[model samples]
Target: MRKLLLRSFYRIYQSVFKMAMPFLPWRRPVLLEGAGSIKKLPGLLEELKIKNVLIVTDSTLMKLGLLDNLIKELGINGCKYAIYDQTVPDPTIENVEEALKLYHKHNCKAIIAFGGGSPMDCAKIVGARVSRPKMPIEKMKGVLKVIFKIPTLIAVPTTAGTGSEVTLAAVISNSVTHEKYPINDFCLIPHYAVHDPELTLKLPSHITSMTGMDAMTHAVEAYIGRSNTKETKKAALEAIALIHQNLLKAYTTPGDIQARAAMLKASYLAGVAFTRAYVGYVHAIAHTIGGFYGIPHGLANAIIMPHVLEYYGSAANGKLAELADHLGIGKGSQSTDQKANAFIQYLKEMNQKMNIQSNIEQIEEKDMPEMISRALAEANPLYPVPRVLFEEELKELYYKIKG
Candidate 1:
C-alpha cells in the first residue's frame, strides 16, 4: 500500500514537471566547437571583459600540463586567473568551498571548469556558492534551489564523457556522511561550453571506455524515462547513435581526433537530454556506490546500468527494443523482449572487450543497506524511472552487482 502511494505521488510530480517544462527557464550554453576551440576561449573572456577568472581542475590535469596552452592564452589575452586544482573524483562540498575561496580572493568575474566532471561539478557549486553566499550547500540538494544567477561559468571538458559542460546538475559528495547528491537548477548551467577534441586525444583507453559508457548510460536513461520532451528524445537518440559508432574507435585509437570529436558531441547531446528529461536508476545507484566506495562515476555506471535495465524487465522492454532497433542490434523477427535482452547483452560485451569489470569489487556487503537507502532517496519521486523500485527490489539489484 505504501509503495503504491509513493508510486502515485511520483507519477503526479512527474506529470506536473512535464506540464511546467515548457514555461521553465531553459537555456543552452553558447557553444565553441572543433579542434582549436579551447584557444578561442581567452578571446571570449577578453570580449566579455573578464579580467579575473578562477580555473577549477584536478591535480592529474596539472601533472599532465594540460592547462599550459589555455593558461598561456589567458595571459596573452590579459585575463588574470587563479587556479584551484584540488578537486577530486566525486567532488566534495569542501572542494566547492576551497574553490570558492580562490574565486573570491582573485575577485573572479567568471569561472573556467577545465578538466572532467569533477572539476566541472566543483566549479558549478562554487558559482552557486558565489551566487548564494548565505545558503549552505546542503540546502541546495534538490531541484531549483539555486534560482539566483551564478557568475559566468565556462565549461572546458577535457574528457569525452560526463557532459558536465552542458549540464545544469552538479553532483557533490558529503565527506563526513559519505553521501552523494545532485543540486539541480537552471542557474547552474554554464554560460559557455568549449569542446576541443584535441584535449581528449591522449585519454587513456580505460578512461575513454568508461566515459564513453557513461555517455551511453545518460542517453539510455534519458530516452527510457517517462518525462521526455520531443527535443530531449531527439538529442538522446543522436547521442546514442554517435556513441555506438565512435566509442569503440576512440577507445582503440586514442589519437583518432574524429572519433574523439564525435564522442564529445555525443556527450554534450546526452547532457542536454538528461538535464531536462532527467536520468534514472543508473545514475541514482552509481552516485551511492561512488560515494560509499570511492568508485569512479563512469565505471560504476558502466557496471550497474545493465543490472538495473535488466531488472526493469517488461517495464523497459518497448523503449529498450526501440533502441536496439535504432542500433540495428537484433533481427527484425525478434520479439521486443529479445531485442531488449540483446541491447543489454551488447553493453555487457562492450564492457568485457574494454576490460571493464562486470562487478564493482569495491562494493561491500556491509554497505548494501545504506547504499540502497541512499539510492532510493535519490530516485523516488524525482527521477521518473520506467519502473519504481522499493527496498526489496533495489536490494536484489545490489546483490546482483556485488563482487
Candidate 2:
C-alpha cells in the first residue's frame, strides 16, 4: 500500500512537471565543439558586448591554471573580471552567499561558471540570488521555484562531468545543517555552454573514471525512470553508447582528445536526458551521502547505482536489458531478467576497470536510519524512481556498501 501510494504521487508529480517543461524557456546555446575553444570564449563574450563578468571556480582549478587561460582570454579581450575561487567540492549556502557578495562588489554584469559541478551550481544559485534578492535560497529547492534569471551566464566546465553546463538544476549544500538542496527551474539553465575538450585533458585518471560513471548513472536512471519520454530515451541511449565505447579509453589514456570529446558529449546528453526524465534513488542516496559524509558526487553515484538498480529488480529489468543489448552483451535468446543480470555484471566489470571500490568503511550502521529517511525525503516526489524503496531495503543497501 505504501509503495502504491508513493508511485501514485511520483507519477502525478512527474506528469505535471513534464507538462510544464515544454513551455519553459530553454534558450541556452551550446557550442558543440570548438577545438581549442578557450580562445574563442573571449571573442564570444566580446561579440555579445559583455563587459564585467564574475568567474566562479575553485582554488585548485585556479592553481592548476585551468581557469587562468580563460582569465587571460578575458584580459586580452579587455573584459573586466572578478573571481571567487573559494568554491569547495560540495558548495555550501554560506559559500554561495560569500560569492554573491563578491559578485555584487564587482558590479559584474555577467557570470562565467568555470570548473566542475561545484562552481557551476554556485554560479546558478548566485545568479538566481542576484536577480531575486529577497527570495530565500531554500525556497528555490522545488520545481519551478525560480522566476527570474540574472545577467548573461555562461558555463565552461573544466571537467567532463555533471552536465551542469547544460542542465536546469543545481545542488547546493547547507553548511550549518549539512543538508543538500537541489534547485530546479528552466530559468536556472546557463545562457551558453562552452564544450571545449582541451580544458579537460589534464584531468587525472581517477577523476575521469568517476565522472564518466556519474554520466552513465544519469543516462541509466533517465532511461529507466517512470517519467521517461521518447526524447529522454534517445538522449540516454546516445550517452550510454558513447560511454560504453569511450570511457575506458579515456581513463587509460587521459590525453586522448577524441575519447575525452566523446565523454563530454556523453555527459552533455546524459545531462539533457536526466533533467527532463528526472533521476532516481541512486541520486537521492548519493546526494544525501555527499551531504552527510562529503563523498565526491561522482564516486557516490558510481557506488550506489548498481545496488539501487538491483534492488529495483523487475521494475527496471526491461530497461536494463535494452541497455545490455546496446552494449552488445545480451543475446535476444534469453529472458529479460537474464539480460538484466548480464547488464549488471557488465556494470560491475566496468567499475572494476576504472578501479572503483565497492565498499566504504566510512558508513556506520548508526547512520543508516537517517540516511534512509533523507533519501526518501529527496526522492519520493521529485524523482521518478522505478521501485518504491522502503526503509528496510535502504538499510540493506547501506549494509551492502558499508561491507
Number of the predicted model whose lDDT against the real structure is largest: 1
lDDT of the structure predicted as candidate 2? 0.87
- State in Å the error of residue 310, model 2: 0.6
lDDT of each: 0.93, 0.87
lDDT of 2 by residue, 1-403 (tens): 8778876877798778778767768755557375678778888888889888999999988888887778788898899999999999989988789989988898998899998899999999999999889998988886788877677889988777788888888999988877886888888889888888888898989889888999999999999987788888999999999999999999999888999999999999999999888898899889888888899999999888888888899999999999999989999898999999999888888898889987666887777777888888888777877877778888888887777
Q: Give lDDT tens digits, candidate 1, residues 334-388.
A: 9999999999999999999899998876678788899999999899889989999
lDDT score of model 1?
0.93
What's the TM-score of each model vs. the native? 0.99, 0.96
Prediction-by-prediction clash tally: 0, 0
On the 0 to 100 scale, the lDDT of residue 275 in model 2 is 87
Off by over 4 Å in 2: 1-3
- How far does residue 121 in candidate 1 sit from its true spot (Å)? 0.3
Relative to the unseen true structure, what is the C-alpha lDDT of residue 358 in candidate 2, on a scale of 0 to 100?
A: 75
In model 2, which residue pairs have backbone atoms overlapping below 3 Å?
A: none
